[model samples]
Target: MISISDDVKVVENFVRVAQIIANLESILTQAKNLSLTAKNARVVALRAGDAALGFKPITNFIDEFSEQTIASTTKIADLSNQLFKVAHKLVRCSQYFHQMTLLKTHINSKQADAMYQEALKSQRRAASQLSLALSELENHFEDIQKQMQSAEYIAVTSRVEATNAGDFSDSLQSVSDFIASAAKTIKTAVVYNLSEIHTLRGVLK
Candidate 1:
């Protein structure tokens, strides 16, 4: 029989997975907002003619940054989903092994022994898969943090360019502020998710 402790562990794994997915969804929304702000900045720059020429190219970079962030977040979300599935399977296999252990005391010895061995094999396989998936997810989180740094750098550059936009300075500056805010939100979400993943990894170990 699966013990109460085993059930608690399974529930903890599922909770962690859900939290990470929710954080990722928040980051994705911020990234889309950043993209929209970039387009608005581009339009403002165009209206400013020669005065905002430098800022126009920066808008393109901002758009690219947002797109890249969106793509990376999507990948991470997929990995997180896969990790949840593997974790669930691992829990189920462990519970099965526990059940078989209990059965060994009441059933035919030979059959129980055979079933016990099979359960052991399945549990080991699930453990191996979960380990690999956690490693991959950790790597993806690191990649996301690096990307956020790049996005933040671009946001700073956009602010500088906005200052030189002549009469359109206010509009461009507003957009730059929005971009920076979005980048910060995305970075915060990523960092939070990464920390949670680290805790989960340590727990698994």
Candidate 2:
């Protein structure tokens, strides 16, 4: 039977994953905001004519990256939930050992051995399946990290391009600033959450 601490660790692991899901939800909100801001930036860029023509590509990249991040964040959340459910099942399967162990004294020696072997086999099977699920979750977490980095890069670059277009159009500059702010917000959101995500991954390992 697993120790109480081990049981708590499973719950802790699940909570850690849930925390990641919650952070990603926050990122998804920021990404959506950035997307809308990018749309506004596009309008401002068009009005600036050639003076802000360089800002056009920035808007496109920001919009696309936001959409990708939104999608990635949502997918990772779903995968985390699935992993938690599966892990819960493994935990439940394992708890059978504790119950069998309680009844050990009542059973004959041969029967107790047989029960132990059977529970051991079942627990091992559950563990193997849990390992496979965890590997998939780790891969999904890696993908999320890459997507966040890409989103951050696009935000920083867009801000630079907007600043460089400076004085070309005051309105365009304002929208550019908004886009940069949105990007900064996205990065800021990831900064605190990514640490938690990495921690969750470490626990899984």
Candidate 3:
């Protein structure tokens, strides 16, 4: 015997939670970008010798900020998962209520029809919200992929600059290769997530 108000409240809460998760996902994407940029800068500074001595402290600060960002994102992900579970429970409760009403002989046809329509509308709205959340996550993944590619380019340019100056070293070459490989891996992951999100969206539609 859940009230309409209770059902509306549950939906509202789920929307709010989804929005929070979207925002946190955006922040995490930016953090990873910043981390990649910092790592590239460190590689550049190591090659530039005494001229780039002042960049070490800046690079260290960026690393610390990136680490903090990762930690915050982890917390957000945990909270989002818990909120999702609650939303699923609420949806099940709504379904049960509908079934109970259907079994009642006293309910008129018009009343039953109205209730069924309302339930269908609510379900559609929930699906829309979930789709939007998945889209946001996909965007975040794409942004990360772009950033990783940019980082790889920076790393390569730095290596070439160092080699031109007769400062080529095995460590610099290793760093360049690592950044390129990491970028490729991130791109693969993003593609997989995008496919998953696309499938979910299609099913919902």
Give the candidate number with the greatest TM-score.
Answer: 1
Comparing 1 with 2 on TM-score, the higher-scoring candidate is 1
Candidate 1: misplaced stretches above 4 Å? 102-110
Q: Write the per-residue lDDT of candidate 3 for residues 1-205, one digit (tens) a residue.
A: 6668667666655665566566566556756776776687687777767755554454565566455556655654774565466456546645655664564446667777676676666766666666556555555556555665565665566456444433434544554455455456555544654564565454334
Instruction: Please report, in order, the local distance difference test score of every candidate based on alpha carbons.
Output: 0.84, 0.68, 0.58
Q: If scored against the real structure, what TM-score would every candidate get?
A: 0.89, 0.74, 0.57
Residue lDDT tens for model 1, 1-205: 6688887887888998899999989989988888898888888888999999999888888888788888888888898999889888988988898899889867868889999999989999988998888788778777767777877787788778888888999899888777778878877887888787777776554
lDDT for 148 in candidate 2 is: 56
Residue 170 shift from truth in candidate 2, angstroms: 5.6
Q: Please report how far candidate 2 places residue 120 from its true position, in Å.
A: 2.6
Best-to-worst ranking by lDDT: 1, 2, 3
State the weakest 10-residue window (summed lDDT) of model 1. Answer: 196-205
| Local error of candidate 1 at residue 121 (angstroms) | 1.8
Any idea what lDDT model 3 has?
A: 0.58
Locate the minimum summed-lDDT window of 10 residues in model 3.
161-170
**Candidate 3: where is the Cα deviation over 4 Å?**
1-108, 164-168
